[model samples]
Target chain A: MKGFKTQWSPEEADRWSKEDYLTFVISPLIYFLLALGAIWSLLLLWYGWLTLGICGLLLWLMIKIIDPKLKAISLDYEKKQKEFLEELEKIERWEN
Target chain B: MVSFAWLDWFWLVVFIVLMIVCGVLFYRLGKRSLADFFLAGRGLPWWLPAASVYATHSATDTPMWVSGVIYKYGLRGIWYTFFSAWCAISAFASTRIFRRSLAYTQAEWQTLRFSGLGAELLRGWIAGWQVFMNMFVLGWVGMAMGKLCHYLFNWPEWIGLMLFSSLCAIYVLAAGYWGVVMADFQQGVVAFSVIVIVSIWGIVAAGGPQQIMAKIHSLGESWRLNPLAFSGWTSGDFPLVWFLTMLVIAVIGGFGMGTSIDWYPEAQRIQSARTVRDASYSIWAGSALIVARNSLWAVAVLAFFSLYPRIQDTAQYEMAWYRLGFEFLPVGLVGFFFAAVVAIHISTISTHLNLGASYATRDLYQHYFRPQATDKELVWVGRVTTLILLLGSFLYGLMMKEITQWLIFALWIMTAGIWLPSILQVVWWRFNAWGYLASWMANLGLSWLVVWVLPEFRVIPSLPDYLQFWIMMVLGALIYLPITFLTRPEDMNRLVKYYVMSRPLGWWKPVREEAIKRGLIKPERDLIVGGQP
Candidate 1:
């Protein structure tokens, strides 16, 4: 929370930043933990609960870090989407 | 053999009708245009495609595959299923980039990414290959269903294959992907709920988790409980080296397109989402559900191992999950379980039917044959291709017995050598189309040599799969990297357009500078100056 950027302008969000890299690391760890945690917890193992608890915290942190950037990117990108769609159709029809 | 009660028949009939009707209800929406039929007009919020992703990947053979591994290798075998974890990083990376590109299929993305003759050739080759590959997949998955039905009702395998696939094609023909996604939602729920219920029943049947653990411990196999159990560093089947290779392939693969076969269908789902964020979350959440689901099955298989500890035959133990449902669940609930199997079976069928049709219609017919086809005409073409793919699957399914070995070789050819080139094409601005094409060609010949031909001739020893991957990657780079530097780069104009639109990550400095010079995107310095952060 301290180092991660919580707010982003459209242009700033368009570039790759530390938030993206942090997510690239965090996302896979959550997947690994979720798999191991689910099985271990189903067996009623205590460490399984601890693993899952950590996974939840990591997931929340990942979202907090990346969601604002994504929101900014999506908002700005949608405005140009119509023009892009038109160009795509032209390419599809070999008119480009 | 299992016998169905009247109530069981009642459950099966009602569920089949509900699934078909749920899909057909979207008929009006699907017929509105080609986009509606193939992509639900690109308006889905995230959850719809998320459920579709989960349902599509959870086929009839999935439990069998999971059961086989967990039974043979215990908890360590979960890594085999972890290949889907590619979506973990992909959700934030390539999924975002691909969503921005607006390409309907990966084949089409080739032409968008590269220019001129080589790009056209790549697009055509990939499109044709995808059409064939989807048919092959349909056959593979359909035959798995056929095998399951034969095991259950003593029906001929062909009857099981043809009957269910034809039934699923009804909605797919009427509604296309709209039908596939909607039916997948219901089917995903049914299959997941029943999986949970039956796994719990199986665990209880083994006298609960505590008892199961006690039995395993008493049998002197406590290592089975350890998820991190390694046989040795590199000698045994569950080697640490293999695990590290799998982690690299599954996680780092997210940065590239087409790193796995699953990327093809997922590309469609990525585009169907309403926004980049929606697309990202859909892929991430869908795969999260898959990872969670595999854990449930892994534990259930362990329970089965505890109950019947010495099933030496692979075929018999592979039926562990299905046996837990039919051999354990009550009479009426057994029927409900069968209905869920049908749900599982056809959800996969519907997705492939529609997916194969998308490649056939969008890439082949519309782009190459009739580029000016009206939306209405394209929608009809989609239906016709859907019918063609369904019939083609039936033929492929019937002949699968003889071709199974060859199909495995074909899959290896697609994956091992082309993996890095796929990543480079996405992340490196200078990875021209010829380089990518050369990798595919080199992999085809080298896979045969390294995997089979040389080994058969005693020219080299049979290597482990992990070793083969690294060797092929290095060998493929030998060919493609030189070809990349030799050939002219993709036209700067096309690269700039793609860069501005997709904003791809990694090694894109030259293209970014050009985009900045052209005023297409603001410079980083300008952004910082204007932002007041």
Candidate 2:
């Protein structure tokens, strides 16, 4: 009876939510690499060096590593917000 | 220097009488209760509140600053104002968020959201900072009016400040927000009249608007297009990275700061609306005033350039314009301009004092100091605090050695500090209280350290100053977010009770249902308000 109506468990949220994946798991390891990559990329662009390929990779890394979410609200804005807040509230409730 | 003749003084007396008469008229217009005092008793229709916001924001400093910025930098200041125009529209579009909280002040949203003892304590201190800054602005406002008066009539500086301060104080004391609201209409008319007359007079003085623009454009490309060019903190012929930082701070960060204060007058105005549309319209309409008032001042600034092309100091350039008006305006227009100055001063100062006292008395004192105080007592506290704030502000001004760069840094950007993270917390889900607090502290601390230590360390980065400011903001947010997630958003449950009362969560149902019915994520919790977290 509860099929669709059942509340999301913390495990389910952690597994399915993109924010959980992007924020918790992937973020820390990428932070330094991204900033360094941007610097390298810019230097390569100026030199017209074959090294530009690595520079491109670094610059792309920097842009991705920055919280793309804060740039502007995404297309799935309201839907994502609802899910995020719910997952957050659930997380808060669990800690209590 | 043109002086105020007897006729000019007579016109000034007449304008004062009109403000007092309007206040008296409104007092008798069934506005005697507490509602009458603040939020115009929440009964003001859309146009009245809208007009009030427009007029109140047009402080004596508005035109003064405009004249200064234009004469110094050309159209850059006007271009930047459009950024604020975007902010106003952004606030209007986000009405769903601002109106949902239904609190008296933005700080109330903090207490409402995080209902823990710890959060409330944090709330009180943050609230105190806002009240202090609001009052701090009030002190400067008094000083501004005093200076205007001395320029207008050759009155003693202290005498002018006294007259402006006492008038605003007595009216605010007599009618509270009620006097201010009605006085707002009178002031708005006077301000608009002055703006119209001044613009016309200025154009005629400069030959014509087209001629004025042409003369202004002749200065140079740097004067014509560069926002950072006039600021003088630039690299070799170009503004350094700091200018880029200022642009970012003024635009992206400035939006957040302005939005955070969106609902400052609180429940009074919110409750006044017959519908949500009315409430939103009230503010949007108020914003419309900004468009014209901005243009009015910009025109005056252009006029200044046309009239006097080579004064370098920004303040001197602006003073020369106002002095020209006093020296040259017709007797009738002189009265209007004179009245407009007082009108601008009263409208702006009254709102600041009321807002400051509201923060100190309602948000700080009532929320923390004496939570159980009666309504009458709270009202008395608010009124008393207003007087105390005025005196305190004047004293602070008297004691200052000079407004140091640090003071300018804080004064210009503290609104951004409080605003950016606070607004971002709602829009950016990764944001948490810890992140908000850390970024808030870091921005101020780093800015302070930059001033104190940067002068010593001498680590000039590859980027310009403006760009450096942006990098710092980005860095601060980066540092804060991880620390926030590490701490957990779960702490926000402290505010759950208040959230439930205002906007109960749909338990992710809104998202899942929308997505699933449309074939995306699986449906989670159904549309049950309190079904789950």
Candidate 3:
């Protein structure tokens, strides 16, 4: 609760599941992919299939750079929340 | 002369009534205190501010601007919108940093970061600049709405400007930011719905996406589909080098320089989020909407191109978007289109009026005139100032014939010179008020001298706006660095407080040491990096 300011309380983070993470990551990707797909189609229509391969490669590169960072941040956030909960449990046991 | 169907009139009147009712309802919420009035008491859920951000940015001119760019440059013109999209990156990285600072106005942020006459001067200067900038934006959008009205109904421009603006001013005056955000939610939905509906209609009318594609291919311009399409350095209106240069400036100006670059509206949105995570998430949500909005505009423009392949009239090109409304929409839906345009204008103007009033009331009035003023008095002042800003913007809007070119130049070129100072203020401890003052003044003076005066007089050969922008940025930096060193650094206590609170990453060694010495933060071997407070 104290280490960093986050909108997600420990309780909220603890409640988050793999589905939540996947949803969070995929939502933006849907928009991103749709936009890129529309643009790529235009490129392919005008220039031919070769431009598709090039754009696909660039998109893959972008996903490589961006996806891992998003996952890592999500994982790190959960890890911090778990650690924080453990600390809270220890304090509660001691007080009891 | 344009004529509206009865159904169009019905939708327009209904939407106007809906917004006024929402404003009157939120009026009670804003009556509580300064924080409540100006910030919704900083307890808003992430989505509200997110929607507001998207709505506020999608001004009356936004589609016209996008359509104009697409008209001129094809699909690649979307990059122009990318200029502000960089703020989403900033949101991911630094949204909480801004939230944790807890400054009401970015101007008020000075006192938290510095001390002495320097802080006072910096605050005053920022407050003044924010007011002017907000007015400028409101006027710019007002002018667009005026033009839109004239094109839509053959009505006088002022009639359209006054009608929508007065409606916006009344609600904002009654309810403050509470009215702005709540109304923005409805406005954003209407605006975005109209955009999507109109785009789809145009695409269908153009024989679908596949058909539209076939049409584009028939025209056969090599650069038409190329995202990297740009004119060469010497001859074109916007050259390849210019786009690349502007990209660098935008990235540096936003992510590197630390300016939200929405002027102050985006910062206010960030601050309004209830929690730090909410603040950051709001940007992503807002950004997604913005991206979708632009893409939708591209679809409509593509359809426009397909329908009218050889139009040569310049004004017609600019008005292509309005033409689509008249051409494609059903009678009732056409009214919805006009209503949506009004919604866009209201969304933008309301935020600016509310924000401009905050600067005048909180930063200028409360800080200087009545530090001991009660909440009731402050709220009263905020309402009056909102009305004043609305009037000022309307007056200024009437004075201008066209603001599109001036706007492009200001955002793209004039702002390039100020980004460094904005960035350095957060990241560097030694960046004092004098440095900020010098850099901004230098940016304005040198930019005017080099870009305008020199070129007009032929003292130097005229260059493209992008090239002029880069030159201004470099000279502005040249002036900024020496002034930073020449002036004394901000007070040690203030620097340490800023460091401990904001946790900005950069040349903050002295402040970090002081924070450690004062036992404000635990000493660590690894320095805090990337503004992680």
| lDDT per residue (tens digit) for residues A14-94 in model 1 | 999988998999999999999999999999999999999999999999999999889988998999999999998999999
Evaluate fnat for each of the predicted models and list the values in order. 0.78, 0.03, 0.03
Give Cα distance to truth, residue B445, candidate 1, Å.
Answer: 2.0
Model 3 chain A: weakest 10-residue lDDT segment is: A87-96
Better of 1 and 2 by TM-score: 1
Q: Which window of 10 residues has the lowest lDDT sum in candidate 2 chain B?
A: B500-509
Segments of candidate 3 deviating more than 4 angstroms: A1-96, B232-238, B256-260, B525-533
Q: By DockQ, is 1 or 2 better?
A: 1
Q: What is candidate 3's CA lDDT for residue B378?
A: 95
Q: Candidate 1: which pairs clash?
A: none
The most accurate candidate by DockQ is: 1
lDDT of 1 by residue, B1-533 (tens): 68999999999999999999999999999999888899988889999899989999998878888898899899898988898999999999999999999998999999899999999889988988888888888887888888888888999999888898999999999998889999999999999999999999999998999999999999999989888999899998788998999899889999999998899889999999999999999999999999999999999999999999999988788889999998999999989999999999999999888888888899899999999999899989999998998889889888875323444465467778999999999999999999999999999889989999999999999998888888999999999999999999999999999999999999999999999999999988777632434
Cα distance off (Å), candidate 1, residue B410: 5.9
In angstroms, how far off is B310's CA in candidate 3? 3.6
Please name the candidate that would achieve the greatest lDDT relative to the true structure: 1
Q: Where does candidate 3 clash, by residue pair?
A: B257-B423
Residue range B39-63, candidate 3, lDDT tens digits: 9987888899999999999987887
TM per candidate comes to 0.98, 0.72, 0.85
lDDT tens readout by residue for model 2, B1-533? 34666777788888888786666565543235433455564456666766677777777666666666556556555543432342232322333344444445556556545545535655676678767776666666666666676665567656665577777777777667777778887788778777767766776777765576567667553365323344455644335444444434433432232333334542345434433345545655565456545655665666667777777765466564465567568866676577777888878787777777767766777666676566567667777888987777776544432222223454334543344565565444335556766776776766555544665566643444354455566667677777777875534334343333233221333333344565443334532332333
